[model samples]
Target: MTGTPRPRTVLLTGASGVVGRSILREPTALRLLAATHSAPAPEADGRRIRCDLTADRLGLEKEEYTALAGEVDAVIHSAGLTEWGLPAERYRPINIEGTRRVIEFARHAGATVHFMSTAFVAALAETAPVALSEGNMCRNYISSKWEAERLLRDSGIPHTVFRPTNLVGDSATGWTSKGQIVQLMSDWICRGRAPFLPAHAGIRMDFVPQDLLSKAVLRAIEQDVSEGEFWVTYGAEAMDMDASLRVLAKHAAYLGRDLTIPPVVDPDTLTAEQLAGLRPMVRNYVAVLRDVSEVTRCSGGVLPSSMPELRTRFGVPLVDDATAYLRSLEYASAHLS
Candidate 1:
């Protein structure tokens, strides 16, 4: 880190979620109060406490809540419903109102918030080549995070936003607590399950090692940084479609599985009738992929990024994209299969 991590106590919300779990994996000097959803986290690597983000004082007793506010200097707000393709309303309770609750607590505690937002919000940029469709799977999720960021800003609470793209695994060992989208989709596609890859031409496939984000956040806390928006993504350094597909092919070979790499189909060229003709299951997956393409295209085919800053400032490892992606695929095949 920048210095011997300045000791500071932090209330880490969503301590049981993927991002939260990843954060706990990193070594840090900050004192942590891990707020979880239900059952206690035996391996939270910090003190664990059950919490309800939608409730007043996060469901803690008033006296206890006041005490908690006095105990922490900052909050790492990582908890949220991150699943895509859900109805817009499904996001309101957690992504919106839960954030509202966090804001209330931050205000009371005079604590700075280090909010985990999404890089997909780049789709809302003014230079976007196309509008993000309401039908897009990620639209609702991205919109919810955008609203949450605005809430923090309007609340006048001291905060910093870390907007990360899709996460894969650790940069070195490629270990993830659970399977992520890249692994799931790579497995299916490598097995020749996909009829065609519906992705926008020239769009970079941006996925980051989960640990990079964790390191950045911890460094921010150690340094007592109370403001700034960081995009923890590889912009120009990200792999293009061809390289992504090549990795799939390599993985298939490694597994001794026959692979017929699917043809890349432009999302715009695919007719509705053609999409409708696939089997119900295939159609669903294809539609989601196509919609995700719409998300990338809307962001001018490249999401906003802050990789250089992250590396220079926070010492996030500069693992090459293809190398990390391949390692993640190999790790999945070996363990997660």
Candidate 2:
């Protein structure tokens, strides 16, 4: 009888990223081929390879590519352009075509693929579930991710998709590589520039801690799970917009910044002049807030259930929203400010 296959070597793209670094820290049996583009190779227990996700053969030399294909057992594709507000053209090559290349590489390597997607792919749904599941609508950044998912699904390779929501700082230390949208809002609020934001009591903002997401990715890899899409988000436990604002307000107060918490108002109620007065970044954020508010309102704040089985099996800790927000705020204050 055939015994179970041995633990496989994993080609982990975006190894210099927050999620990648966190994954590297996990105690796993599988070997890692840590890949980065321009970021310095991480000083971790893994083989570091400089790779460009958008390049032919991932920017590897002929021999390197051949060696990778021969030895790699799986690929965790986590690299992509995640910035919002950029044109579709800017995202297409990196987010879309880059994913295509990853899929191609995985195919050649005969490797299982673990794709990193986004929960916002569900933002385009007309009816939002209390917990978002696989198969949803898309637009803008979401659109690119959705297309990437499609490419993976059709790639004929064994793959699992992870759609994580707004990843915050680490759950314990609050360190983060990228300053996300929430950080931007916090920065604006602390500066007293954003005195108002559009929201309602029912508006839920999902913020998954970076560590939690990383652990989930590691678990998926370690378990060699290749099934349906996994929604790597807090789901119903997502903090309400008002509650999030309160947390930010508390941090602002601690920083000796005396300012009124921004009141949530309907975006349409604001005059064009008022919108124009806001910074371009904040203005774009407002537009997104408005869209999310509309979708949440229509869907009655429902989302897909959280992945309890994954958590239970992997011993992943539940994220505390209050603590996470505070940590993120602290990190942003230290770095962004």
lDDT, candidate 2, residue 182? Answer: 72
Best-matching candidate per lDDT? 1
lDDT of 1 by residue, 1-337 (tens): 3767546889998887778888888898888889999745544765677789878778899998999888789999999999898998999889999999998988888999999999888897677778898678898899999999999989888999999988998899888877888888888898889999999889999999899999999998888899999998898888999888888889899999889888999989999899889999889888877887788788878888999999988988889988888888888888898
Q: Tens-digit lDDT track for model 2 on 1-337?
A: 9998767899988888767777776678888888988886454566789888778988999899989998998888888887665667888988889999988888888888888888776654555444332221224677788889989888788998888877788888888776877777777777777657776456687777787877876777777687667777766777787678788778888888887876789754878898888789778767666665554544455445455755896567876877897888899889866
- Where does candidate 1 stray beyond 4 Å? 1-6, 39-42
Superposed model 2: Cα runs more than 4 Å off: 1-7, 125-138, 279-285, 288-305
- The collision pairs in model 1 are none
- TM-score of each model, in listed order: 0.96, 0.87
Best by TM-score: 1
- By summed lDDT, which 10 consecutive residues of candidate 2 come out lowest? 130-139
Error of 1 at 112 (Å): 0.8
